[model samples]
Target: MNPAEQAPSYRGASEHYLSPSRRDPVKVLSEEPVTRRVLTEALAALALPDDRPVDVLDIGSGTADGFSLLTRAADGDPAVVEEARLHYVGLDVDPEMVETAGEQVRSPSASFVHGDVRSGIPGGAFDLYLSCGVPYSHLTRDELVGALRSVLTAVAGRGRRAAVVVDVLGRYSVEWQPNWHLDRWDYAMSFFAGGGSGISEPMTFYDAPALTSVLDEAMAGTGATVVSRTAVDRSVLVGRHTATGTFNPGVPRFRTLVNDLLRDPASVDPADLRFTPATGGAPRDVLDWLAGFAARWNAALQPYTGAGPLDRDAAARLAHALLGLERAGGPGLGVGHSFTTTLVVDPA
Candidate 1:
């Protein structure tokens, strides 16, 4: 799919953020603890000069929220925020987003660019390169590699060690398990409430292995070498784009529980369900219900464990179970809604 066609939705969303009441849900969930954590991880990987302003480039930077998060996270540390100045440059395909970001992210050292990062990254070498909000999910596998290669070459040219953070949609996320078998799926709706141009765009999903392979291939001939990688986030709840028609409207109790869980993951009480819909369990107990459903789900997916693709039905079932449970221990690579990988790139 052409990236330009999908610009309307993002353009509309950028305008929505300008409104006091409206906020992008994906950014809200990711910009805080999630982005901050990854930012810290990525920054810690780089060997940056403390006496100079840290040059940072945010690819697919929508509203420059990640930049803001970085500044806020380092507010207490005078070294990162003050002594080493943060010169942030953000790039986005949507001109409106670029414009809005330029206005909202007003800083002496911040700049916004309207361009496609896959073709070429703007500016000189940056100390940090961030691609959050699952921007890479929109690219084809080949395009992703080419884009990464371009970025790596640019960074390599400067002969500077940099930190690059890549964020993508997880294949094992509960939000889109129904379509996990496909390498790509059409996602509809805006990520914000009362946002989105009511359009669907093709998006790719990835597990840690698949993503790591892409990065390795992209950097094979470049000066950038990934030193470390860590996946984080476990968004067990429904995402804004998937919530519109994710569940059957005929089942109100199940739908209500799912909605509640999405609204606040920690505030939900699974015991409040008035009825047991699909997964057989007592209506008053959530863990029992999750365990039973998980057994069935894992059983269905057992054949695909460390093997081939999961059965669509089985994937959907596992996703449902995970959503109902709202938490789990295991791999964050393929399971998180916004699974992030922070790589400390060593300059060639």
Candidate 2:
């Protein structure tokens, strides 16, 4: 099988889903909320047809995770998107993934198909194109551009408004501080037990500028004009790899500490949450941003240090404060673990 066609090894997929890391407070409180916010904004920007259900195409869908995500984004709010009005098609290159998705997502409005976006997008034009899990990061830069160009061209041919959410690995995540100097490198799913298929693949990483360039090139002459682009950085400090320390050993186990704080504030020592970024390699601005964020993060923890186990209320408040700090840090410049860009496209 082509390396590109290889499905992410899910030998322990069930274990992974049931793992604490999957349901950690950071994932539920920060990552999912940010993603859902962007997805909601994208849906709101679209001009839906009253005559038919809104068509959605999920590229690189894995076991219909994107489908679940979209459902949550709608949150049964008819004003945003009604569950009954959604017609979802999930496309992937792995037949096993498609079959698994079909088995998992038994929605009347949802279907899964095997297809690779780099070669072509199956089904047809859609009102929204969605992807998650940084699937596009599996593609080379040129391949991603080609895949996106095909999507834009299809939207243009349809002559309708649409939205595309592109998710990719951020270049400057502290989890891989050592590789900030390189855009592409072997990234392993070390978080999984037994090293997740025990295979490392060369994955692409992107900053806002690089990703914007790819989108611009893909849109050029495709008769698709971007109405707006919103970039969001998810998991700036609490990325999964922070606990594994696989790529950057110097990084603190922020994910584990945060999860501990969420579960039982007394279990974590606030002093251990201090973030001291690895120096050199990354851009100065990125380093500075991390430094600034670290200062705030540490300060937030200072009140709890030596203060003994926090009461339930205090612990909840502190967690909320940290999440707020991440949100107020300004537009994402690829500082997070996952960088997502949602483009509202006008195929006029």
Candidate 3:
């Protein structure tokens, strides 16, 4: 898929919902201060030889936490605010996100871009690139290579050093399967206008190996070095990223749902594919609900976005049946099986 062209719609809602829902929610719950401390300490431990000011590029930098991290530590941080006037460039796929972040953040040398970080880095070399969430994990190998090429080109030309703090998906993270459709559904209904299927659909993802391998390759191409890295629980993954840990997919039955989702893109409607929370909805067991949603959505959406040869029409028909408010349980899981991957990305 053309990352640039197919980037808008999906990324739009993704940035909005994940920014607040997943990233903003569990800071305290997951002890963000501790994670921030780890970052500061990591920087401090860096063998950066020169006293030259470091220019930092935050890939998937949602809401500009990189700036905040430079100020004071988060919930459990022990690192003193070794503040530096970093030439910060924050990038996100969502144009609205970059706009909102630019308005709220203030820095003499800071800038925000409404461009694809996966398109590679912006002009000018950077010293470090940070990503709290596994944003790189979302890109394909080609885009990954492009992004790395951009980063390396910038720094190498300037004779500067660069490092990337990436979030790595451990083999066991909840909701880490080739099932991104559920997320698309939730993102659309909750953020986008109601929600409807369209031209080209996105591939369902949970590309752990691809993420790690691509990043390793990206870094390898760059003469930049890796100083220190660590990964804690999602209690630390703040702002728009899902909470780290195991979650439950509430649907009792799910195999059929998974198949249908893997088969069609326009099969189900966003509204029908949801889980109610405790205050009366179906369920909010993050893992369970998210997994179930993904399974059903993947089965239905994959046809259109075929990860392989998933029949387009058949998948759409199945999704349609599932999303038919009459077919789905109105506000429940109806009768489909669900899927989930524990959110366990070891950024170590």
Candidate 4:
């Protein structure tokens, strides 16, 4: 999508975030925790000096959600984070989001500005540059490169070590199996009421190779060298769309069944959670991963199937096993709802 066409509109985004689906068990128990692990690792790598407050720039900072996530991650070590206070600056193109964040995240150390990453990343030399919620997916391939270049340039200019977390839609998510062969598509936020303004917008999806190429191009001659990089997949099977079934209706509602199990094990029928892989245009490796995951996922729920309503203890065990499966699935290969690549850059 062109930069102009990709302008964010949060008309119903707040409402969507407040919806019950947003807090679904899969998200609370699975997605958020996995993402937090990544963020925590990135923060630890920074090893910020205790001299001054850490400056943070959040790209596409929707309602300062990234701020909240970072704060929680830092909260793990209150002495380090509280002593070196976080000075957060969130940038977004949507005015409503900026205003909402300003109102909601009232803090002397935090502020929101109306801007687009494609134009430029403002107020940098930051200790951390964060993007969550697949914000980079809104940009076309070229636009993504430009945005990253801007970030790299800023870090290099300041000649300070920094961390950048790039989150984008995974091209091979089971939620959109039909589009595995394509890098970009019209993605719909179908979890919202009435199918979320009934509009689908063009979004760029990324596999490891494609995203690596973009980052390489962005780093070219930017005077920034990547010290380390880590990539992980979020929501391998229980992505929100898995329950909505808007794109891949043939897939099982793993998200819904998981939520049911989390809320009330007695209300769930284990048979409904069985995963059956379908033939698609995805690469053999991706298909193989899905098949392996499906086998394990099914096995986890097998003992409970037809065992009648599960007791609370049994249900908790199943949930823990499922979450462990997702975490141990290994590095992301675009086989999840969102793929996050964290880069620790040395501005030499």
lDDT of all predictions: 0.62, 0.80, 0.44, 0.82
- lDDT ranking of the models: 4, 2, 1, 3
Which of 1 and 2 is the better model by lDDT? 2
For candidate 2, what is the lDDT?
Answer: 0.80
Better of 2 and 4 by lDDT: 4
Question: Compared with the true structure, what per-residue lDDT tens digits does model 2 show for residues 154-237?
Answer: 988897899999999999998888788899999987776422344478899999889989999999989888999888888888
User: Candidate 4 — worst ten consecutive residues by lDDT sum?
Assistant: 75-84
Question: Tens digit of lDDT per residue, candidate 3, span 1-348?
Answer: 645566745444435433443332123223244345445554555445556566667787766766666555544543233445456788888676677678767766678987787665677665566665445545655665677656655655666445555543222222322232232211112212223222133322222343445546755645544443333323111111221111234322232232334444344333333333222222334345435545654454444442444355655454444433212211111111111111111121
Query: Which pairs in model 4 have colliding backbones?
Result: none
- Give candidate 3 regions above 4 Å deviation: 10-25, 29-31, 47-52, 75-84, 168-171, 175-212, 219-348
RMSD of each candidate?
10.1, 2.7, 15.4, 2.6
Query: Highest lDDT, which number?
Result: 4
In the range 227-281, model 4's lDDT, one tens digit per residue, is 9999998888888899889999898888887777778788778888788875667
Candidate that beats the other on TM-score, 1 or 4, i.e. the better one: 4
Provide the TM-score for each candidate, comma-separated: 0.72, 0.90, 0.52, 0.92
1-348 in candidate 1: lDDT tens per residue?
Answer: 655544545646764555543433333332344556667667766755567778888889888776766776442542334413788889888888888898887778788988887658886878888887788888888888888888888777788888877778876544554555566777664444445454468887787677878888989888667677676644533344344434223322333344444454443344332232233211223234334445643454344355434344544443345443433322445555666777777777
